[model samples]
Target chain A: MAIVSGHPTEKYVRIDRLPHIWCPGCGMGIIFNAFARAIDELGIDPKKIVVVSGIGCSGRASGYWAYDGFHTTHGRPIPFAMGLKLARPDLHVVVISGDGDLLAIGGNHFIHAARRNVDILVILVNNFNYGMTGGQVGPTTPEGTRTTTTPYGNYLESPFNVVWLAAASGAVYVARWTVYHVRNLTESIKTAMQMRGFRVIEVVSTCPTDFGRRNRLPDPLDNLRYLKEHAVYKKNPDPREADIIWGKKFVIGEFVKIEGKETFGDRIRRIIQIAQSRLRKSGSH
Target chain B: MTGEIKPGIYFWSGNDAIAEGAIFAGCRFFAGYPITPSNEVSERLSWRLPQVGGIFVQMEDEIASIAAIIGASWGGLKAMTATSGPGFSLMQENIGLAVMMEVPIVVANIQRGGPSTGLPTMIGMGDVQQARWGTHGPHEIIALSPSTIQEAFDLTIRAFNLAEKFRTPVILLADEGLSHLYERVVVPDPRDVIIVNRKMAKDPRNYLPYKADDDLVPPMAPVGEGFRIQTTGLTHDERGYPAINAEAQNRLIKRLIDKIRKRKHEIIDYEMYKCEDAEIVVVSYGSVARSAKSAVDMAREEKIKVGLLKLKTIWPFPDEVIFEMAKKVKKFIVAEVNEGQITREVERASRGQADVFWVGNYGGRWIYPEEILDKILEVR
Candidate 1:
């Protein structure tokens, strides 16, 4: 019966909208708190920050955050955030949603946004399965994992290692952490927020109701224990080597961080400047 | 005379006029995926928008294009996107989201043939019905059809103004024929054009994000404006909090529909020609109306009492005008490029008061004046 009320980062929480819909032992609350704490530590103006989320269990985070939050449609947060940032270059836009929402239906947008190096911080909460719906295997679901969609153990050969995909897609900054690594997750979020180009932080979290129960980890806390035991905390592991092979150790760290890169917005401004100059030369303006 | 004409009179295609109109309307953001016919709108804006200190993004797809425009709108920019039939279909669900969120955006669907990517470079008014009901739900939208390249410029500006005024998505439904049709378009001074911006909240604390005023449009506080506004696709109350109940749905949907529905008279624009004492009235829109006008003129020469009614705004139906015309005319010939989309609307409005005949071409071909003149002759 512990409430999210009076939490350290309570100012960022929407007290009116609670109690949240997250299950008793779900790790979304932890990740959500870490995000709030990150924002707090950075002392960023909430007014200048907008949180855009797509549909999922984690998509609900946008509703709980006391900021300019857009709880958008499924698989579309990245594009929505891109538009927001492009419109108001002064505003800090962030996309906080589930792994399935960002990687599956929204995958095209994800890579394109990365390729463009649009300025936005994306916090992907990976729960391995679709939690809002029944236990359904998702894009990040481990091979041989059991779910409602894959009852007799998943036959899918490989699950996407999001960190590698993001890096390969030209993300300026990419990182991965589990909900259990609170300090690491918080610090990563803070860094991503300040970064100018497309930044992604994938937080591997628990889905007790759907994913945890279907697997051997019936209790969500056990899932946390598994993450803590199985994760290898590294500073900058090779993105290609960051895959989670389930039962084997998974590397979690800031995989990529390229500084002094010109963002898509900056490049666009340059394009406009050049085009306007050309127009002036031709006396069209 | 060709070189000495007014500087405003530029030979521009319908699609080109749309882009110029958008810029004149203070549209500072254009995000779209390139599709035929409609692609020119985006291509023109790509360079034009940037020159005006605006942003143009070629998105991954139509859904992203619409999504980006909605985001740009919420970010306090006059935003728009252009697409053809297939792209328009891809944009339906997000368009619904834009409706529910009450985000102001202008989506120009330069319609081509379709059910599934039927014709990429041809004409189709098949999307006339889809323009209204494409997005799943009970929400109403403002969709406009323009006949001339000039109206394309004028109505595209009007579309932005109406979108800003009503805080709803406005569909500038054009066709492949009109999109590519090059004509002399008069671009007005930017100052002469009336541009409406989304009303912003005056006070931070008391500003109910969804609270409609006498005009039925709530003042929007753009994100990053210190309002800390929360907007969602889900049905919400005046405070913009998720309130999923019959009461909330009823109240929210009523305002969403009624804002445009009740103000239909002010929003609806159409042209009627020589309808007095006429036996047959040809109802048409977009490029088809041009042929319709020619047929009406030809019929008049033949002593056939025929008139023309060109619809500028498709949604909100202009029911009163059509019904009024129905009462006066013996029969109405509804001509379009599609089988019989808006014909049903004329029939429904006529309510059996007038005999309705459908003059439609499937796609690819424009409804020739000869065909309409023949229809008028047969009915006469």
Candidate 2:
């Protein structure tokens, strides 16, 4: 297997496809690197894992990973991963997509999957704007942030506090991290991998080419430093306080971790058992 | 439970028969959102699938439903989804994706009136054109239309078989009338039925996931089957690697089209009723075909020479059959529940060899035999 030097998880990546299409100083590579490290450290069989992604910059991560990967349509990786997880409960399905792909157009699928507690790990990379489509303002764009669509500053309402949204929508595990917080992000992924139910780890990533350049943070690292400065770690903060304000304040850390509730697969199996017994009693077959 | 299908005669609706047929064809995964005229398919499979050790999921919406089935098919299971007109419209983009990736999955569109939820409880062949041209792309599709409840059962199974055999998404286009109509259907034993699975790569070491054989269909290696497969809707090369060059694009698109087009003779299916010496051949499909067949019988009794040509496989158009009929017949009456959809195809096939008359309306009801007879009389 071809491996890139220095990265412990380089063996997990498709080195033949490198170098990746990510822009210079993009945060997607960092997040993907962290994911590879987490998966590598966990020592899970690569053949048992499936990586699914939708259309966006972050969606490219599925193609870069050396696994059974699917680059699906825009805004559909959650339900796509839902099918993979539901059909073969033995495989570990992970959805890695962008904010625009997961939250803006695919918001209904996101909340519903969380509500049903489908057993899958979702890593949502929020780059504040739609990076692939030339940085249009998106669902995660802060209240006053300027983008190609909101050139004169956004007059729209505040963006979603996804940590709170995921928690309120019944995600069994919820956490938030930044690209700069590599250790914390990797640790959160590792913990979520061992856990069950709908686990969501929102990574606040950067889009220097589109979001940062328009917002006057021309250097991509400046956006990373901004995230490092603003994010406050809270063990169980109110989801309402988890909003990301541009160049200002935000909240991070694991917010929700409630176990013992039945996952979608567990409930489905139980329903099937009950229905089968009912059929047997009725003697239909 | 894994391979045995209960063989018996039962009075069943088209939706129920389709669900049973899916089970008989080894569809282990069904993901769908309930839509009128097609909901019974999902409801029946919801229980049937579990008993057979399969999975049935009622998704949040139709878009998710199709997307999920594609994922499940990639996960090494034969998968299917059911929907009606509006839901089918929502599933178009993913249908195109399924086409692009050449995923072996079945999508049954029990069509109702549409242009957007026009009629929920009524029937229309309004989706005939949409079934072919709805998805935005340059690609060939196979859509099978069924008239009777029994054909519904058999054709649904054939849809799955054809999808796997051709490595493409096969569509079962049943309308609202046929979906709700009940009839006696004799389901064969699972051992008796012919089930075709995708050809898998024998040597995993040199498995090029998109490399085609002589028949233009590549052996499919499902994800997680140790082939470490990578599949995407984007233009890709034989190795399943994304390639953006003109040569790769031409190669991929050409194979996708040729794989089905070259096998049209095998994929195209239809029933010709008394068209050997008739002057008028009424072209129709779905429920309209039933009434057209009756009208043809009535015309024959009245000594007005007419016949019925019922289309079972609607999409690889069966233009050859139409052309043959056009040469033999003096006039062609295309009877459907939508305005000028199949009629346009009949006219195109006729090539001015015969006069073409269209008997269609958006009344959200099955066109009666009397109305079709009137069109036949007008054509005469």
TM-score per candidate, chains pooled: 0.98, 0.97
Q: For candidate 1, what is the DockQ?
A: 0.60
Let me know the TM-score candidate 1 reaches against the reference structure.
0.98
lDDT of 2: 0.88
**lDDT by residue for model 2 (B249-272), tens:** 898989999989989999999988
The model with the greatest TM-score is: 1
Candidate 1: tens digits of C-alpha lDDT, residues A189-272: 988888899999999998888988988999877999999999998867999998887788999999999998999999999998
Q: How does chain A of candidate 1 score by TM-score against the true chain A?
A: 0.97
What TM-score does candidate 2 get on C-alpha atoms? 0.97
Q: Which runs of model 2 end up more than 4 angstroms from their true locations? A: A1-7, B1-5
lDDT at B47 for candidate 2? 79
